[model samples]
Target: MYVAVKGGEQAIARSLELLAEARRGDVAVPALELAQIREQLRLGVARVMQEGSLYDEELAALAIRQAAGDMLEAIFLLRAYRTTLPRFGYSQPLDTTAMRVRRRVSGTFKDIPGGQVLGPTYDYTQRLLDFDARQPAQVACADAPLPANMPRVLDLLDAEALIEPIEPGNDPEPIDLTREPLTFPADRAARLQNLARGDEGFLLGMAYSTQRGYAESHPFAGEIRMGEVDVWVCPEELGFAIEIGSITLTECQMINQFQGGNGVPPQFTRGYGLAMGEGERKAMAMALVDRALRCDELAESNDAPAQNQEFVLSHSDSVEASGFVQHLKLPHYVDFQAELSLLRTLAARHHEDTDDTPLCKHGGARP
Candidate 1:
């Protein structure tokens, strides 16, 4: 039975009110302060900042709280907030080589210069859940002085002719993706920016696919560094670059073996990934997927799902994926009715044609 459905406005209003109430939680209990979230839920804040392409910790934390701890929704919230923000100016390419390294590691070499500093990593921790909500304990401060700066492991490789060298230059201005639509055949910078803001799960899945004989890319994690990098920009009037604050970044560079193809000799190839915060998994996954997407350029077989640029890049953002998938719950009655009418007509026509056909193939007698 078809009934005229109404009250969409009321439903939406109620939904909004419920969302607000849920986000706030019980009024009796103290509301979560932004600082508490930023400090305690650092990982969640980092994820939101990484995926949202915004480095503000406090804002990311607020988004997380508002989204009720939903990471993807938090990312969406941050992105929406980001759209309304005014861009002051572009920052110059960060000098990661001069990064104040907290954690740096290289997988390609057994030993490298500056040595491996596995600083503050959860990689080796047991997965057993801790059932205690212990109070924060203070640790004694170290009296010894810390290192002023640390060099990148990859720079040591560059010293030798083992790894391909990247030259420093004035990076061309980047187009704002929010302000402008993404176009096909994006440049390396553009692609990296897209991948950095992309959904972690989606990128991880694509990376996993490449390893499972999809793109057949033999990738090695050349280096993964997590630290604070200085952001600089040269205003035309200033005529020189100025440091515009620092941001924590996780950068991953994947080394791939490219056999002689596309007129290029057998050489070590590169796949790069950089995130706004400590997002090692996302960065590594992004590097693999980035290389997989470049199969055509390297003249590799492009039969894999990972190698399909359109498919990989298009579905990489959680915001877009979640919205479109959930949007089916919205109004679609017109389309549904059309489909229903077409199916009924097809069924009736098929039955009528069958009924008209004789039961016996030879002459026309009813059984």
Candidate 2:
């Protein structure tokens, strides 16, 4: 349906030139280095990597710069670049229990095993901006190094047999969503994969809706940990796992009250979310929505929009949504002309029919 126009090739080229010039802005200003964006605007870089489904910080920074700091566009750029990459062996499942804890907190408990280690966060800071550029302040050092592996707060509840147990090893192998087209009645693994790369803003809104009585899962932020976790890969030839590298991650575990159904006893349920880099908000939002989507599996009411898997998964990709909505700006000349011709024909037919009829004083056409 999209026929290429013969003309305007030169104009498009000129427009692209203008776009490039505009992206550079004033030449007087120094160009932004990829390293600066990757380090200084780390959160933005993390969001790009998370949504783009790519973990290369340098590339993410480049995409961000190329997109002129447009987060969604940056995500799209990174994702587009990712499609051309060659497939390598998949990494082993991350072990969060062994994370080099930088930040760990829990709303369910005040004093968790590794008392709250509040890392660099904007939570307690004043919103006021300082006009003067200030030097970095010195950070106080901890008396003792943190334990190699901190015990998960959820484990305490698990010990009491209060929360549902997620036993490992029995679940089927998860499919690569990138290579496979998503189908209806998707399993939890697929759903989680979709959500992990979903637009953060969309997920946040859906999660907020759940709290506003839409799905009404009595959710508590059981634990949110941000740190670096080692990535391992096992090659077919080697038959042994090797540490490829480590990547920063944020993991959120949400506890929700569940009056068990489907022939199960009442027990607390859990919703999990994980993201690349320090993406606490994204992780938390994902967790809430994840729980809401589990309504069918948990035998709860699936009346809310958040519980609609089709709607959520379909609309979650910012790149796809942006393309579909923005494509209206494209040349629909043929389609528009057809519609206009049809309308004109209908109007002419009505006018011709009216010309042979007599109009009464009340403006009604007389037979």
**Top model number, TM-score:** 2
Over 6-32, each residue of candidate 1 has an lDDT whose tens digit, in order, gives 466667889999989988888999989
Best by lDDT: 2
For each candidate, what TM-score against the reference?
0.89, 0.92
Candidate 2 RMSD to the correct structure: 3.2
How does residue 193 of candidate 1 score in lDDT? 73
State in Å the error of residue 4, model 1.
Answer: 8.1
Model 2 misplacement above 4 A:
1-7, 133-144, 347-367
Candidate 2 yields a Cα-based lDDT of 0.93
In order, what lDDT does every prediction score? 0.83, 0.93
Q: What would you estimate as the lDDT of candidate 1? A: 0.83
Clashes of each: 1, 0
- What is candidate 2's TM-score against the reference? 0.92
